[model samples]
Target: MTEIELNNEYFEWMCQLVCNERYSRRLSYQKLLRHLHNIDFQYMLPMDGNRAEDGIDLRYRFGYEKEYEGSTIASYLDNSPCSVLEMLIALAFRCEEHIMTDPDIGNRMGQWFWNMIVSLGLGSMSDSRFDAAYTDDVISRFMNRKYKRNGEGGLFTVERCKYDMRTVEIWWQMNWYLDSIL
Candidate 1:
């Protein structure tokens, strides 16, 4: 496929994630967050070296949340592929350049990432370690810290942020699967 076409596909996929809250709202909270954190999103670039929606509500309801409420951290980590979050990271890695160049796109990814963390649980909000994740000034700068709803308040300001792309290299290596897909 041509570069533009590939980029378009990538863009639309993300728009769905941002626009269609139904899927995101129903994500497996703990599983999604864990998966999101593990995939390095800082240096991954698209094969070709390749937008925002509305709210950032970090709420969830899904397979694990129901049957796995009492699941321990170990179990949650080993939770069978939640699919969505990891898929997102893979996409980010595939289209890193396209995503990084667009502040809106990067911010949305950051929004999605932060929302996933909040969706995990309110306890994560108060944890200092959450803030520690972006201690790297570059990673911290590309994210959005003012994404609260009209009056939702930034109770978890540190954790509720999203990436704005900026000029930083916030992506890691692309997923191996992208080799054939691209």
Candidate 2:
């Protein structure tokens, strides 16, 4: 998988935060994990009018219960390219079996990924659309965010992605609610 250049501190901190709250009920985190749980509820399929708050069973782990270790939001982000947009789209694509013809891939894993993408603001789940170029564009923006063009306009000053203090601080604030539970 191609990695997205990221402010590693922001991305890793988000990863670690998700990891820590894999069992907790952080709102945004849960918003991102709604579809990875049990099928007993059987709320509508992801592509069919699935909402962010839909499929969210707060008490349950996003994937299998603690009894069996399985996929979770933590694992999804870990496998991603570090761009939120790319990560959501990429993971959704990865879980899909029919990449070109369908978006849901007609399976539980696919549904979960699709729903999570919708919840996390990736795109419309109802639309059966996929774009490789858009994914590339998103990655480019993320890569460009870490560098500044030189006066020559031909070169860039490579500041690196991981050390972005602003992103790290934003993540810190976004996840501040977790501190109370931790």
Best by TM-score: 2
List, residue by residue over 1-182, the lDDT tens digit for candidate 2. 11233223334433332333332223243223222211122212333112222222211232333332333344432342223322333333333432323445433333434344332233332223434444344334332333222101101111232333223322231122123223
Which segments of candidate 1 are over 4 A away from where they belong?
Answer: 21-182
What's model 2's lDDT at 93? 36
Q: Which ten residues in a row have the lowest lDDT in candidate 1?
A: 51-60
Error (Å) of candidate 1 at residue 56 is 23
115-167 per-residue lDDT for model 1 (tens digits): 33342232232323334344223222323323332112211222222332222
TM-scores of all candidate predictions against the true structure: 0.21, 0.23
Error of 2 at 99 (Å): 36
RMSD in angstroms, candidate 1?
A: 18.6
